[model samples]
Target chain A: MAEAPTNPVALAAESTVATRMSAPPSFDVADFPVPTGREEEWRFTPLERLRGLHDGSAAATAGGSVKAEVTTPEGSGVTVETVSRDDARVGKAGTPVDRVAAQAFSAVEKATVITVPAEAVLTEPVRVSVHGEGGVTFGHTVFRIGAFAEVVLVLDHTGDTVRAANVDFVVGDGAKVTVVSVQDWADTAVHCSQHNALVGRDATFKSVVVTFGGDVVRIHPRVTYAGPGGEAELYGLYFTDGGQHQEHRLLVDHSAPNCRSNVAYKGALQGADAHAVWIGDVVIQAAATGTDTYELNRNLVLTDGARVDSVPNLEIETGEIAGAGHASATGRFEDEQLFYLMARGIPEEEARRLVVRGFFAELIQQIGVPDVEERLIAKLTAELERSIA
Target chain B: MATLEIRDLHVSVEAEGGPTEILRGVDLTVKQGETHAIMGPNGSGKSTLAYSLAGHPKYTVTGGTVTLDGEDVLEMSVDERARAGVFLAMQYPVEVPGVSVSNFLRTSATAVRGEAPKLRTWVKEVKEAMARLEMDPAFAERNVNEGFSGGEKKRHEILQLELLKPKIAILDETDSGLDIDALRIVSEGVNRVRANGESGTLLITHYTRILRYINPDHVHVFAGGRIVESGGPELADKLEAEGYEAYTKGGGVS
Candidate 1:
């Protein structure tokens, strides 16, 4: 097995029109050219809905419209600070992989960094709430978990804003971290964010990304290992309504030996022009022996006019890995499932609700937060009520 | 006691070439507390009768009249029919991937019984019914019929029959895939429901093996979409010795 060089010039030379794998990764926004919807990564996304986030036209303005609130457990040695863009740890976890991400890197005035002290076991989750007041915003947030520290970090986004931001997680050796990022934006908002995680030796990183509201929301989650024995789990759930576009793209780069990764995302869509897309990519470098990974994406179309695109790709340079596989499926509600429920005395409408709820139950349970799970279920029920009417 | 009466029932299903009739003039009567077995070979329209009674959309009633306790059963929707005391245990139960058996049972009970069941008593009753069928308690949390073995599916159908307590229960081919042990267990569940004397049992099957455990009060031989012979339990014994040969000769019951 030969490892393809990851250099920018070499990758550009190997670039082909059929795949996004050749796109070079760079920290500078100019390294990658602006997309024209011809690239595989940008073909499914509507460029106009991005609100100038991709072309570097959306500039930062004064009078910050988005407010932030942070809460941490007492005596946990946790610190939250706004650091300059040139700080030493600004891009330590990940570099900008695309133009928009790189533009976000160069545009944010200040980046927020939340750190947990080594060996600190927090009994409560650290919560970050960001509310927008109708304006264009660019931001960055990083979570640095120390060795052997176990904590849950929640990022809640709301309100209306044309927002593009970068979120990074730097998990220390032997650390356990769970990050839940929720996008419950206003209907008029447009959101695009890139989540990058650098997992350390023997560390565990679990992420749950939930998107429900927003006119156009696109999230890219990427993971790379700092050392061998690292593990990553990514779970996502989204509900797309009439005229909404929601997309999630994920990449797990297994450059370290003995690392494992699992990705599962489920979505439901209804009404005209409702669209959902999920792309899962797992790349195992030649040296990454004993790497095990699997990814799955499933979508349930609840109405006639909705559409979904699910693609799962696995690029393995080494055959010595333990196991690697991927699966993708997009379909409408199973008529037999509905009929089964209705036969048991459940009315037609309620039967549809139960079937949809059950389709998402597995991923929702992975959130591991009771109140969050309950709230999401309530929201799902309300969304389903509209279909009945 | 409730009575289910079907008079000259004509049912058709949409096929590639216009509508194809499946049950042409099926007539029968099932009274509460009685176990009537409808025996027929494959393609004899046995399951169609069960599904039609439950008002499956695929089966259209071109001409028929079905009444349960003097109420028009044919005029109601599928769920309405269930609430109106009609239950059909399909031969191939559908697999519901995410709804747990316990949750499905509770929801169905809530809809049929018109209110939520008391938590304490409902849990106890479910546990008791599972125990009677020799089912593991852990099975209650599993998805309904998803990945269930044939025997397990039959047991689950009977489990519902014992729990829902519908006025009329149509068990379509409940003995098709059951092993001897599962057959005994499922038969016992059916007997318990019949012992209540408030529900009528329409046990549909293709074999007489299950007749050893669940003795039908009356047996009807069905062929070519209609009942050709009806008699006491002795009819089942005769069919066991002699197959549906006497009924299949003329294609419409010789």
Candidate 2:
């Protein structure tokens, strides 16, 4: 209950890490034991459904399963290269903290490094499209932005495959980076990924994760400030249908002075056995003074059989911070909203669609991409039509 | 002419312990072009009659028969009742966040009129109506009742009444929290629709203030969940002078 200490006096405190993470960050995959369904981090996950990605039994059986392509505009001073895992840029942002991420790091055959030089502002977005041809794949990608640079990066996934990937972002001082990762895989696909961001002094980092399809998906994004005055924002949106499991776990480590972090994630679930899990952890260390942070998660359950588990954990070790807070809410379709719409001569089905669309309107606007927004709106309509049918 | 007939209407709402009957064996009739005011005190079930007619799911009809021009109103669903020309201007309109007023009105108009309204004319009509209500053009972009003050909520309800054009309009305490200016504007909106002689107005209120603007053909004193006395427009003045203390003392459905 005691959070957000404002003054810088001698306040007795102890800096700490989240107890949910049983192991510390390490580069070696052997350091982490294979997760069962019982560990704190894996409690809500259906470990058996991860297609052997958790226990290291799954292999790259299908060769052409996933094809990766990166597009950069002409003379943009951006370089994209496919290098071996020994590349100097590999793991520059952060190391793997869990089994799936560590496994991807140790087994990745090649790493893709995209570099945006200092002070170069991009006029067009750098687009990466990962097309799943079939089977299984492992990948690692590093994005390093130079100081005072600005860029909008979009990564899109499609088709069917079993994948485990590690994506790292190294943001330079005073740089502004916006990353949008869309997990729109086929219903038969399985995906587990770890995203790491090392934000520099006075830099701004924003990442938007959207998950719409897949039998199972678990995404872990960790953030650590490298210098003072940095800011990080993590946003996520998911829509879970019947027999699907989607999970997002995030940790924002405010390690430097005057750094700020904000996180928000929203989800809607329908059909029987649909499950959504959101775990947000914010830790303000003892030396990180003047830190301001807040996190929120809201879930709208559309049907009876769907379930949602939302947890917001805030741990402030020092009593000399500026502000810290978190909130989580899970509610069903509001009967009052439904009745209000119905009484306006709108049918039940149309009224439902309107309410659901309105619920996601704010988050969808954050994408800032016209074509992507239009596509999401169309996808939302299609998702609603399934229930109506 | 459209007519709404309510006979032996009994309604109950779920409470802490169990179902508690609110409207007990009430009878009333409202006809097109007629404004009937049902005056009562705090717990006399005035709002119950409005919600029951509007087919709200919260209030259950234990025993009743409601008919609009000889069609069974109770048999229809909420939206069906609206399409059949029944409307209730709720005291506390529900907040629908992110649903802009323009979008809500257009959708409602499309549903009631069975087709989308012509854009140019519809925009003109809405703009003019909002002007008459002294509402700013920017209000159309605000979400429905999301952060509206009391007066704004009442005005929005009346705006819907003007646009939807239901044959049977039930104004439940529409003047409860309005200032004099708002009361006058809302009253004029109701009168404009009434002048068409195509809809009946059932105005339920605890105070006689709004009746001064919108004259009622009949004034009914309600107590014990039923109407105990009926008279002409002068009855409103009489009740306004003496108040409903005499009628509600030992007169409620205890």
Candidate 3:
């Protein structure tokens, strides 16, 4: 399905700048012209480091696969199945908007679909652990949650592979969904993926994306409202190390009236040539009256030769909106904050840990899962100890 | 008894042109249980003296000798100086977002005491200390000075002063911005420490108002980036009556 192209006449009549992204959504790999690193969306990404995920030269037969294991609570009544490409619910949530996603859709042999019935409140989170075994992989996943249902999903990615995938959430009206996706891939891995959420009327969807490893990892998360009163919250945390490139791009499309969306992403970069990029784009269509939106991005540069680029773009087509705002800041470790803590008898190393931990503590608590929170904290501690030492 | 002795302390800070000297030569010795008020006009380098003693990286000790109980203080790092019984309550306390007051205090105490205090006793200690300062217990969970008002920042500094219990405590214009009620409340906390006779106090101020609440045994008149006049408590009385015009009249920058 090709996304409807923007009408220049309508744009002129509405007197609003064109905000529809240049590339239209499609499930065919041939729709997107090959990017030469000059395209706005491809500028910050190192196309070469993608190892052919962009150009389709990398053989999909790299002799390894991403094995997935799903654990459902007893009597949870959640059904997880591997279905063919013709599954009716597969593309209902989202379609490919970029070449990598289209390639993933065209290359995958099977798709995984998870479903929950209406009004079911889950006491335990559905855990999906995907392990890559050193290969080229393309995949697709869809989660369909029924109306008024409450669900928590955890997607844990590990191991080494060159992979491109698309994951979508089809939330029903008045349903609430929380998704925590952790990308702790190996250092040799190259990962590029897209995540989409179609929030239903009066529904709430929250996503936490944590990235720590991989030579080059780029994730694009896009959210669109299915009806009025829908809400979407996107939060992310990433740590970039020496010779690593991590980029996170987000889009929140307020296509319905009376919807809300928020975005906050934080990253810490260290070592020579470490680069982290954050791009947040929000569009309030003419019909999205009474919308409320805000976005924030913050980065901490821990060492010399590190770089960060943060950009936030907000476009409104209607004058009747509740509110909109954005803020972005990238700073070195504050000397005064460190000095203040050291003067209070905290050693230099401990002081550094305190400030870095404090920086992430706010977002970690928002995950709402104690087990994941503790594990992430432990992972952060190990990372800090290594960096400081 | 602990003794903090400073002799011929000269400090300079980096300016646009070159190194500009802030403290020409400061000499003082504060012994345990002694409260010495160093009153001066603005830009007299009183805060410089405080920061230099606490080993602020911004200041260079061009020529100086700072010792505590005959041990070289100039040789220690900031945290070492802190653990070695030296504390500076900054005039403008730095904000540490996401670090709770309780966690900060407990961490500082652990570093100073060389071990973590028993959790039960530590909570009790913090509760009692906050009560005495008329502080709400909820403040403990609040971030360190993130959005605290003027009086609240000052009170937090004093809270640390009492909780950390360093041998030599330097208050850098801590009374600069406080209401009368807050002034009395803060002074009472200082007086409590002074009465205990466990730590020496170096009170830096631009006004004589706080002197009424916590009496000083000695007062030094600071001007021209150094002390020009030294006297007993009578010196504070004189400065209150006449002001520092007597000291800054002759080519000395105020």
Candidate 4:
């Protein structure tokens, strides 16, 4: 199979609308068919909350500098450009996501395009920091890793603001990409983000999203293995405190043969009104022979009023696959695990934090970038300290 | 110094049919610097005795007094007993994924010793212990017992026993799955623990191969949920020569 051209004509057609770049991608909710709330996929998603998104000046109100910087073992890099706008091409993704649609438009209208040079192996990471100040806002980023290259991208969302962010990544053939997004906003921030990745042939892509700061946080993360032998792994770790609602929905599409995809997500929700939801869908196509895939979602709900809902789905259309399996579980901390740690003289709180950290550490170690892993650890520990506080 | 005594012990397990007494009216005592070997055939309750001594939640002790250094061991939780200087090298150690052996040993050591060891000293101790057991030092980073061979698992048990020094270490069939090389290394580790002079040991085995390196001060024969015979080191040799056929044929009742 030949590699996808540097500039695909189909993708180029959408770029022509760059001239009509508006303030924000505007779409009347009535322009699209109303989901009767009957679709199996849309059943659980709160449709009413989306009404608050539409007809609101939230997207236009988004104005703040996202201090984007990239630091590697070698040195730091500068931000090339930050594009914040809604691209109509993203809305035609043929997916029924009421939340993603408005956020996609709002994100495409305001996107930060960061392009790493072709075949350039940057030893350092490219950091894009998105900062929002007061009102409801949106931020988006498009990261393109050139073919046969390696790069680490860290998206740090901070500041005292309630906003939504979209992050899209395109990994070229034989390229290796590691992306770590730290959603560490102020406690009062409302963060809704989308993370999408397209991995090419023989390419390796890893995404680690940590949601430790936010009021109502939802991450729509999707990964598509578009070429054979590509490997895609997505890991999400979220720790919620009191009165926080965090949801993570991930979709992995194995479109080509022999591609491998794995998802391991863990979250801990504590205190009153703490709620978390994890939805994972792994689709193995008919041509994806010899595809080995596995997904596991484990959540710990520590408090009487806290709730966690986990769903792991494996949809295989072909029997020629090598292996496929998924597992999901949500509950409070294991007394046995806790006791095992406490018996070691680790105090109760320290033991619980250790277990939670260990739970997410398993996924963090899979991120493959030492810098990203350290940042995640620092961010996660900071959140843990605050939660225990 | 220290002493571990089980007086008139009665242990029962909830089997498919009902509760069946596993250890009945068994009395044993071992003082510091002494190693006691309990040899028995299948279903003779040798492992049950070890579990009962370690306070495994599965084994219910109906009547017994298990005292470690004059402290009631049966009254303690499994981990509590361990913290109170009681260790059980499980016959079949459970494989825990995502938890490294070194991490588990550190946690266990901290639990038993009531504080974390100095990082430099702890690393040195773990390396020295693993080295003493003929284990690859790299094994410390591998998941606890996950994907380990039979000999490796048994050695891992010995690894914990060496790290978590106890007043009385109960090794349930430690020699069951070990190869001659692994068996020798495990025996050496056991001897090193005893060399400290502060820890007694209960070495449970079906064969006497391990007895060559570490001879026990006392040998007890278990048959039908009770210790039918008690003798010195030669008894182990006699049983190794004739097998448990003679003991069972003698028809000792519980």
Candidate 5:
């Protein structure tokens, strides 16, 4: 099926499916259609790369395949269930009706089901690790937290091998879940991951995604509020150096009353021809009264050749909310603050590091888990050191 | 011995149409362990002298030089001047957000001393100093000068003075915006420093209140950007009774 053109009408329809990103795993194109470049929402994103998956690239073959592991990690409150790969991948033979339809259904058909027990409070996080030593490998992982259960999940994407992977997530009602996903892949790896989360009424969900290094990376995190009084917090930080292209697309929906959502993402891009894009959108329906939503996206362009494109969008059907605001800025370091620090006897480079470290310190401290916080700081500092050279 | 010699110093700031000179040929010398008071009117440029001495990026010094212990203070960078033992207890200290008072003080002390102090000893000393100033020790954990009341910020400035122990300190209007109680605590902190007998102080103020407690040996009246009259501690008492109008009416460019 051909994709719709980018326009207001098609954008409206795409917005609907984009809003339902957190729905249960189902590979039915009729349910969730692939948004075309013609839609205003998909304008800057290169859909052509997504189409690359169909041309025998993302196909799953039984021979010479690689397997990924998902382990429950310490300090993360959830657990993972082991599922067979053959049961998860359902596609066979040649082309299907719709490309999106074939991809979604095929993955959902063979998804490994990890369900959180009701009222179960998990203290250790559920860890997911993916390792591929050969050609590109594609897989889908799904998580469902049972009602009234509280759990913390940590997704660790790792591989000594080079390949591509896709992962998805879903969160349940009256349940509070926190997910911290750290992507520290091999320098030569190509990573393409997608995360979908559905939040139920009075349920709170928080996700933090950090990417250290990747060749060509793309992450799509789609969250939808299914029940009233739901809340979601999303944070992402990515560092791309030496011709790396990292892009993260986020969608947050306020579908019912008393819903709240917040997003804050920061990135530092360095070296020649390195590019990073952060696309964020928030939707407030007419019924989402007393709804509060806010988003902030900041990019630090450290070099002349490096570039960052950021977009913060608000789609409000009616303005009957407590508060709604969006802010975005892409720029270099601040001079006055630097001068103040320099005046205090700190060198220029040390001052820059302090300001940048302080800029992200609040989020680092808020990570709740000490080990994860330390790991993140070490990785981020290593990237900073690379940028200095 | 370390000495801060202000030799025929001339300073000015931008005014209506041209430069309005604040200090005109003002000459003063502060040797180690000596305290001098610069008493003047609100616009008499006492703060200008302190700011100029501290190497504030603003406050142009058109003539003369400031030398500390035989080294040219004017040529030194802000941090360099600081590390060289020149501390300014700013009248309006900046509120640096996202930086805790302890962190900032430790960084400043480390830079000034060129090495980290013993953590246990430093903490104990900081606690003792805070107690002397009647400051809550919790203030040290808070961000530097952020959300502090007028008296609290001033006392914090004194806390830095107690910790850094610079060779020469220029107190610019530290007495202003302070209450009688805060003034007493600040004066006591100054006395403790003087007790060391190894540091010099240049106290700049418009009132004789702090002088009554600090007990400076020399008091000079700054008029039209120059010292029109100089005397002992009695000069501060004289100014308190008579006011600066007499000096303003009689003085010309000197």
Candidate 6:
């Protein structure tokens, strides 16, 4: 059961959470103090709009307003369980890196664990849908895959509420997994989440994060390899409309030898006050010999008064790595492309639509889900019509 | 029969300082089923003429009146010009990422035809057009003009020319950056369209090599942004034998 504070103001007055820290990040809420928009990690984030998730001012009440439903494929040898916070497998995948994530870890009483057996291949995708019924909620979910297991997981968020959650993914040796997380909340909702993935030896992990709705949404996805020969691919696509704030922060750590990582994220912003931010970070340690990594971010401003901030950072301690590079570009629709399309007899409005559809087509096809791809295309078309209208 | 009439055309393009004149008081006309070859040296404003007729935004028409079958040509928008039966085969076709050639051709056809083509016949039409261009069938699925070789791009332009079937077609340097084989193939496509006897062709080029393939009904030697000489087909042979130096002396129009 989840809880909500009756008087938010009183809770804020009683809370004495530290607002500064000079040490490394830890899972404990007290260890990593609440951010006051001064820290490097929290500089871009709007502290006041967090709904008190950062500080312990928003106490939990037994409301259970957010409901989560998990559906596994039939005969896939998958099991789902609800365990206490003290469960041994709770924090094996990753530890929290920020105060909000730490607070989420301390708030959720029961954590959901979904496990796939070793050497099992799922023919159908597993789906987890979380629907918000109002109020505030905190959640934690863990996905554990055994050695050589192959699975596709789809996590969907919807409805209107304030939410702070943490999701952990643990991939065993030689396992292959694809996770598609979509944030399609109501226009009045606010969501903050941190996703951590740990790839085992020779394992392959692919994560696709698609954000389309929500008032203020921030998602952080981080990856780290436990052994050599592991490969990770991170892809993201987001659309921000008027008065919406969407942020994506990603990190890939290559600590083991011969590991590889590639990241590409693209976003389109429209209308006034639409802001989209992307931060890509790749760190290659001294022991990460033969490490190869590349990151790219592109933003398309569809209309006036929209802003995008794209930052790509790479740190290499060893020159022995294979390769490391990054690129960032932000622009509006190219006039040349518009002219080319129009010179062929397509009307101005239709040509504009086609150009934008083409911009997102490449990434949409990479999703590999036919139904989901079609839905996204339809959504994008509707969004384009709204912008024009 | 359709007639494209140009009267004292004057065009200029914006530069760092101000508006720089490109086409200065030029006049040309083409009747249906006629191929008019405009040959000139570099910087002779030959391409500017082609672009001006197609109504490019970069080239401003300061003083000009172009009429296509008695309709104002300069007043129409870029796509409106295309729908009104005016086509331009650009020298450097732009690349449109994520848009397949098949989709682009169909969309263009739909806009010009005012309705979607029948699925069964449209597929056959595309297949036949690609085959006639000697293009591999896989190219239809590739992005429009993306990573296409120079020859392939020219062939693609021809493919559109054959499909769109506009009343007036302006080929701007269509022969440049092409090998002998590609030149022959592209020329044959143009010849096929000319054989229809329903569209007028305005071919702008720097060399007379392509004239050997597609014999023009009229030849115009352009110098100093205006036509210096106009004659029959033999004028091309004379110009090819003797370069434009005879027409251009002391950088003055003869």
Best by TM-score: 3
List residue ranges in candidate 3 displaced over 4 A: A1-22, A59-61, B250-254
Q: What TM-score, to 2 decimals, does candidate 6 have?
A: 0.92
Every candidate's fraction of true contacts kept comes to 0.70, 0.67, 0.78, 0.10, 0.20, 0.75
Mind giving the per-residue lDDT tens digits that candidate 4 earns over B66-172?
Answer: 89878898887666777787777877776555677777788777767888889999999889888887889889988767799999988888888788778888888
Better of 3 and 5 by TM-score: 3
Report the C-alpha lDDT of model 2 over A1-389, residue by residue, as the tens digit. 00111221222333233455546666677898888778888889998888888787775343535878899988999999999999877887777777888888888878999999999999888998998887778899989989999998899999988898899888899999999899998998888888888888999999989998999999998888878899999989899999999999998987789999989899999999999999898888788999999999999999999999998878777888989999999989998988888888998899988888888877878777677678788888888898655
Worst 10 residues of 3 chain A by lDDT: A1-10
Clashing pairs in 1: none
* TM-score for chain A, prediction 1: 0.93
Q: Global lDDT of each model? A: 0.87, 0.87, 0.88, 0.73, 0.72, 0.86
Q: How displaced is residue A43 in candidate 4, in Å?
A: 3.9
Q: DockQ for every model, please.
A: 0.76, 0.76, 0.86, 0.17, 0.24, 0.75
- lDDT of the structure predicted as candidate 2: 0.87
Scanning candidate 5 chain B in windows of ten residues, the lowest lDDT window is B245-254
Instruction: TM-score winner between 1 and 3, please give it.
Output: 3
Summarize candidate 2's per-residue lDDT along B91-190 as a digit string, tens digits. 9899887689999999999999899999999999999999988898999999889999999999899999989999999999999999999999999998
Encode model 4's per-residue lDDT on A1-389: one tens digit a residue: 12332222111223322211222222332343444445444445454443334334455555544454544344323336644354432322223244444554533455556667667778777777776566666555667777887888887877766565566677788888888887887777667666767788899988888888767677878777657898888888888787777778887777689988888998888899787788887777677788989999988877778878788877776899879999888866666555544433345676666667776767888888887778778877777787765
Q: lDDT by residue for model 5 over A61-165, one digit each (tens)? A: 412234556665444445555565454322211112233324534543245656676677877666665655655555656677778888777777665343334
Considering TM-score, which of the candidate structures 1 and 5 is the better prediction for this target?
Answer: 1
Task: Report candidate 6's fraction of native contacts.
Answer: 0.75
Selected candidate, larger DockQ, 1 vs 4: 1
Error of 6 at A345 (Å): 0.7
**Which CAPRI tier for candidate 5?**
acceptable
Backbone clash count, each prediction separately? 0, 2, 0, 18, 12, 4
Ranking by DockQ: 3, 1, 2, 6, 5, 4
Between candidates 1 and 5, name the one with more favorable DockQ. Answer: 1
Candidate 1 residue lDDT tens string, A101-195: 88778788789999998888988889999898887888899888998899999899999898888998888888998888899999888888889
Alpha-carbon runs more than 4 Å astray in model 6: A1-23, A55-64, B246-254
* lDDT agreement of model 1 with the native: 0.87
Candidate 6 yields a Cα-based lDDT of 0.86
